[model samples]
Target: MSGNTKIDVSYVAELARLELAPEEKVKLQEDMEEILGYIELLEKLDVKDIVPTAHAAPLRNIWREDKAGTPPGKDIMLENAPGLIDDELIKVPQVLPGEGMS
Candidate 1:
């Protein structure tokens, strides 16, 4: 690819939601040229037998074995609550005004 490839810096800034200053526009144009030059250099690499991949390692969920265990009772769970309670449940403020039974 030719290093002569042109980039519309102002148009790209609009699409990317950027409010670049006048000096930033000049800097961005030069930086974009360097970035495109790097891509042009990468095009010369040979990868005939190399497989394409999204990452360097395989993607999979790594999880521990699911084992049953004892859990604290409700009385113990509510011991640290800093709010009001009714029976065995903790009480909290209403999410929306005039929406709950109160």
Candidate 2:
């Protein structure tokens, strides 16, 4: 990586579906070049003896004993629902746009 690094800021912006002003393009190009330069520096590090790990520190799952909880009564459940059909079933938005109709 060098000061004369060339990056197609317009191409990158297009790929990201972003419209950048001329000044913004220049700023983004410089930022992207800096980031790539940093990555290049990282690639030069000696990691042969270093162990690859998902995290920097050891991780363990905390366990807790499962306990049965009382379910809400039908009346309370109905009251909390946004909408209900015939006061018996929960009404939700149709998933498919124009299917499942005669």
Candidate 3:
């Protein structure tokens, strides 16, 4: 991209659903040109021999068979609760008016 070429910042902003001021549009146009300039520089790089990779580092899924685990007993869980009712149920603050536990 040539520095002399113009970028339609207003059109780009409209596509992005942005309502940019005149000064903002001017700034955005300059910023966009700089970014495109960088892209142009990148296009000149030689990478024919380099292998394309999805990530910079190799990755693998550490998979294992899904298995059901035993749930903690009611008594064991109740012991950890800050507030309890009937020595079994965990008590929590009401989330909605007239909508607490029956």
Highest TM-score model number? 1
lDDT of 3 by residue, 44-65 (tens): 6778898888887778889788
Error of 3 at 70 (Å): 14
Clashes of each: 0, 0, 0
Compute the lDDT for candidate 3.
0.82
The candidate that wins on lDDT is 1
TM-score of each: 0.47, 0.39, 0.41
Regions of candidate 3 where Cα sits further than 4 Å from its true position = 1-7, 14-17, 62-102
The deviation in Å at residue 23 for candidate 1 is 1.7
Instruction: Point out the higher-scoring one by TM-score: 1 or 3.
Output: 1
lDDT of 3 at 19: 98
Q: Quick one: how many clashes does candidate 2 have?
A: 0
lDDT of 1 by residue, 1-102 (tens): 676769879999999999999999999999998888788986688878988887887779789789988898878888888775575667777877786776
* Candidate 3 residue 12 C-alpha distance from true site, Å: 3.7
Runs of candidate 2 exceeding 4 Å displacement: 1-22, 68-102
Assess each prediction's global lDDT (C-alpha) against the native. Answer: 0.84, 0.82, 0.82
